[model samples]
Target: MRKILHVDMDAFYASVEQRDDPSLRGRPVVVAWRGARSVVCAASYEARVFGVRSAMPAVRAERLCPDAVFVPPDFTRYKAVSRQVRAIFLRHTDLVEPLSLDEAYLDVTEPKIPSPSATATAQAIRAQIREETALTASAGVAPNKFIAKIASDWNKPDGMFVVRPSQVEAFLTPLPVAKIPGVGKVMEKKLAELGVATVGDLRAFSAEELQLRFGTFGRRLHLRARGIDERPVQPDQPVQSISAEDTFERDLQLYEFEGDIRRLAEKTWLATRRTQRVGRTVVLKLKTAQFRILTRSFTPEVPPASLEELTSIALSLRDRIDLPPSTRYRLVGVGVSGFRERGEADGQGSLFDDGERSPDSTGRPESL
Candidate 1:
């Protein structure tokens, strides 16, 4: 059996803020800028107890924990720390797949360092991280990626869990179906309607029945329900897309979305600078007041080279929306895709070359 480990830093951003500032050590800390549009990047455990969490609006976090200390995100420092943790992972195995700045999957089936078991290797890595970075991390060891990922979160900050190959089924059987990867609230509710509330319950449905109901995802659910995930851990996976979206406090008409579109575009533009790739497609996403989602995209011959060009293109996409002028929207998103290595794409297409616009049939955001 292959040995996989999912290592995740505990409240990474907030922990760093606390580690560097002694005065903030014991207090509720939130990492985010002060603004109506700002979202919480991370929340310390102290803040989490008060219902504060990452991705919630800063205003909501402030209201949830009135005494919380707010600190602006310092990505430069976070990236530096991430690099340090990555270097430590390399000491055990080269098969590291980073999911984000704070979490990664490592295949240690044939580790560089000698260990009696995957659990031992995980403990060693966690110990080394603590000694070197003065930061805590949680880890999960299992036969595959999905289960390892779930086990990693079973124990909170600075903990570890292991599931041997023989124990996979028993470990997964009683858990809620929502614990499966990709099983979000919508999927959970759908499964609930079918009398499938747990992994054990999901096992009762034949793969063919599920495939008839969920398409390709039905097959995946079949395997996951049986504690099977055949996917391997791949190192250094390339970035396919980057985007930012927001749900407004109130619904807005089509013309009223221009400002939000521009702001989201700028946010997406700044995020793209973190990578060395160039984006060839600009995408505009909208969610109607009734929760219907629509997307419009454009692929210019030449990739946008400046923030102004990106913003202008995103704003221009509003023209393609065929919805009624009175149609109100509750959310707006801006994105860039078709990433190419720097200098690999020679912008040869004409400017303002628009692509197809389509509404999501799944009533969900398309996976980037």
Candidate 2:
């Protein structure tokens, strides 16, 4: 059995805000724009008491808690703090897989400091995060990712829980089926109609039965319901794609195409800098006011070598949308994918280099 640990920063964005601002401490705070269309990005525990939650419309959040303070998200600062947290994880083990800016899974079967057990290692990491960043993290230690993930969320805000191999089944039974990953509101409703509201109920279904009903995902659901997840912890997972999207403060006319494209391209470039990988394809995504989605993609002879090139391609793709100039867009996004290292091509070279030769033959330097 592998020793897996899930570390989740508690209300990460809200905690960061509270850590930086003394006055915001212990108050109901919602991180979001105070607008009708804007949704909450994060909410402090104090705000959660008033039914405020991430993704709740700001207007509804205000109705729930009239005095709730609203603050815009600062992803840059959050990302910096995330780096510090990741460094803390690295001090213990290299088998760390980041799920997002604030949560990650660590396979610490062989920790750097052998004195502490896996459970203790999780505690130490969480403690170090609190001491160094002045933020709290909840940790879950278990034999596998499925249980470890659930354990992390069992107790929130500076808490730690462990699921021993022997106790996995008992621990999973009776838990709501909705707790299982990928079982969203729709799935939950469907399960409810079938009286499968809990993990125990799901366990009663055979893999064949689940597969017949839900397709391939049903088999996954059956396995997960039985507290089994065989997926291994993958470190330094390859970046399949890099994209940046923005929910505008206000929907803007598509006629404002140039400005939106430029802004989105800059955002994408900034996001890609973190990976330092060259991409062969560029994708542009747009969401119209009517909630319709449009996408355009391009693969060039030479992938964008600079942000300027990326911006030019993204802007050019924007013109291909069939929407009228008067149409309004609620969101805009730019992305680059099909990453490749120099000298790495398909068949003769790296897989990503298939049919495309690098401008320079010398291999690209490995990123840190």
Candidate 3:
């Protein structure tokens, strides 16, 4: 069995704040910028006691816990800490797949330290993280990602749990179906209607029955409910797309198009920087006042090599809109797609090739 470990930081941002500032300890803390448009990015365990949560409006969080201390997000500091945690992980194995700044999956079936078992490797990694970063990390050890992810959350705020291969089924059977990844509110309700409230309940339905209800997702759910996930721990997974979108507090008229384009282009650039691959197409997505969607794209002679080029091309496409100048919009987005490794050979010519291009190019990026 492949030994997989999922490590998750506890209330990452809030915990970091509390660790650095002793006064914030034991107090309800919410990490967010102070503004009407700001939302909570993380809440301390104390704030959670008051029903505060991430993504809730800062105003609402304030209403929930009037004494809750609000702290602005410091991505730079968090990223520095993440690097430290990663360094600790690398000491054990290079088979680390980071899911986010504060969470990752590590395959330590053959660890560098020659641990006696996967659980020992997980404990060592968690202990190293705590020692190096003064931060607590919860770890779950299992045979696969699905089980490992569920196990990691079983114990929280500096805890560890392990699910042996033989115990996977019994361990998952009693959990709510919602515990399965990707089973959101709608999917949970649908499963409940079909008497599939728990993993064991899900197994009562045949694979064909699940397929009929959820299309392709049904097949995967069937396997997962039975404590089976064949997906591997892919190291250096490639990114599929890069895009940035923003929702404005109030609708904006096209008269302010230039400002909106600039803002969205900046956001897109920020997202692109996070991925190592380059994109061949640029897309502009606009949401009108009535929520009608309009999209324009451009595949330039030379794919943008920098954020400035991306913004310039995106702005040019925005100017091509046929709508009346009075068009009002509530959201604007910029995206880049058709991503490929920098030096990887693409069947199609280089994005900058001057030869005949595909008609679908429309000098635009592909859609979701």
The TM-score that candidate 2 achieves is 0.77
Candidate number with the higher lDDT (2 or 3): 2
- lDDT (tens digit, per residue) of candidate 1 on 25-118: 9899999998765668899999999999776768889999999999999988988898999999999999998888888999999999999989
- TM-score ranking of the models: 1, 3, 2
| Model 2 agreement with the true structure over 1-368: per-residue lDDT tens digits | 79999999999899999999999999999999778667788899999999887766688899999999898999889888999999999999998988888898999999987846888999889889989999999999999998999999989978999999899989989899988987876778888888898999999999998999999889999999888898898888787678777767778887575787788788888877777566778888777665556668787777777999999888887667776778998777788887877556523212221121121111111221
TM-score of each: 0.80, 0.77, 0.79
lDDT of 3 at 47: 99
Backbone clashes, each candidate: 1, 3, 4
> lDDT for every model?
0.87, 0.82, 0.81
| Candidate 3 per-residue lDDT over residues 96-174, each given as its tens digit | 8888788888889889888999998888888887887788999999999989998999899789999999999899889
- Candidate 3 ranges with C-alpha deviation above 4 Å: 247-258, 266-332, 342-368
Query: Against the true structure, whose lDDT is highest?
Result: 1
Name the candidate, 1 or 3, with the larger lDDT value. 1
Give the clashing pairs for model 2. 344-350, 345-349, 345-350
